[model samples]
Target: MFRDEKGFRPTQQIFTEVPPKYDILNRILTLNLDEGWRRKASATILEENPSRVLDLCCGTADLTMHLARSAKQSAELYGLDFSHTMLARAKEKVALFGEDRVKLIQGDAGNMPFEDEFFDAVGISFGFRNLTFENPDARLHISEVFRVLKPGGRFVVLETSQPNNRLIRAGYHFYQKYITAPIGGLLSGNRPAYDYLAHSAINYYSIPEISEVLLEAGFSKVSGQPYLLGATAIVTAIK
Candidate 1:
């Protein structure tokens, strides 16, 4: 059964304070690579032209807007997040697309408000790590995604991953810890949030590791494509 209230209070607290500068900070932290990653993931998400799509944990609606822009005219897009502040920012951005086409909802990931097998495809960009890394209800969140997706639906994720190369992994961690954390914290005035983000990204699951997690969650098939020296990856899991 789903929890009555939102879980992950600490993560929620971090997010509550970052929405104002969240988008710009992300661009700065990722050197603008986050946009391209989302673009690629959005393209992959729409390849099947699913009639209904969801951008789960869709902070700031970056991926949601991408999906709306590329999806077929008849396709419906939904973005769900726990932060009202994040959803407010997302609402402003997605307004360019008609409201009827793209809907934004404030809600928890571990306990979403939707019928079973409701969506044809679900996508998360940079937010999956927030849901799963060190989260007590990680499996519940994944199960919620699985439950909401159609039998043959896809769960596409674009997120930070550990590099396979030992040297690159070390460098990546260094960049995340030293460069990303400081700069993002300084710019966003949320050092603790950035610190936590850097810590999580530095130690987040590798592509293979996360793929295994998806497989264990009952996905029939899982595949991944790494990018930028394997510092980030896009994983697609079929239900």
Candidate 2:
């Protein structure tokens, strides 16, 4: 496992320990902007009209539910996460979106349990950063994403990115470091975990950097769309 400057590892324990308030905390931390990110990612995947889709690290199945409801293609959606508690919550909400169409699995991002070329499209929102922070080589997991994608499959990613505007970038860093981390620790009682995540966002790769990484992972035609003043980005690529 790779350790950041603070020696924090983005493991399942960090996530599972705060499952009960994870959704609400996310809403507060991002000022409800996280939903828009998921919406855009799901809309992009739905545009492909894929028959089968996987929501990698689909915490609480928010994106999975959105895809099932928005996709006119009647795509079969699957959500995978390493946290058992998170998956449990996802299972409880599966029926509202038609359980037959949406399935949830507890699994690793690096070693996904699905077969190669099994999905027509794969979408992961707000989860890729954790994998990148934890793994020594992010390609080990990105390669897994490539393996699961069918020929010409699309990969949709929504994660933190460096802000382009100097003023907005400074503000974003301030909020993540001083405000978001403390608030998350107060709410979830896991200061170190949230602190590491907050730091990760401020230090994560730029949109172009992530695009290049995907290209090196054997993806062709990579594109990144920035959102929320460049603080977040939606990256799309074809296998």
Query: Estimated TM-score per prediction?
Result: 0.94, 0.93
RMSD of each: 3.6, 2.1
TM-score, predicted candidate 1 vs. hidden true structure: 0.94
Model 2 ranges with Cα > 4 A deviation: 1-11
* Per-model CA lDDT versus the true structure: 0.88, 0.85
lDDT of 2: 0.85
**Candidate 2 local lDDT, 119-150, one digit each (tens):** 99999998899877545857788999999999
Misplaced by over 4 Å in model 1 are 1-10
Q: RMSD (Cα, Å) of candidate 1?
A: 3.6
Best by lDDT: 1
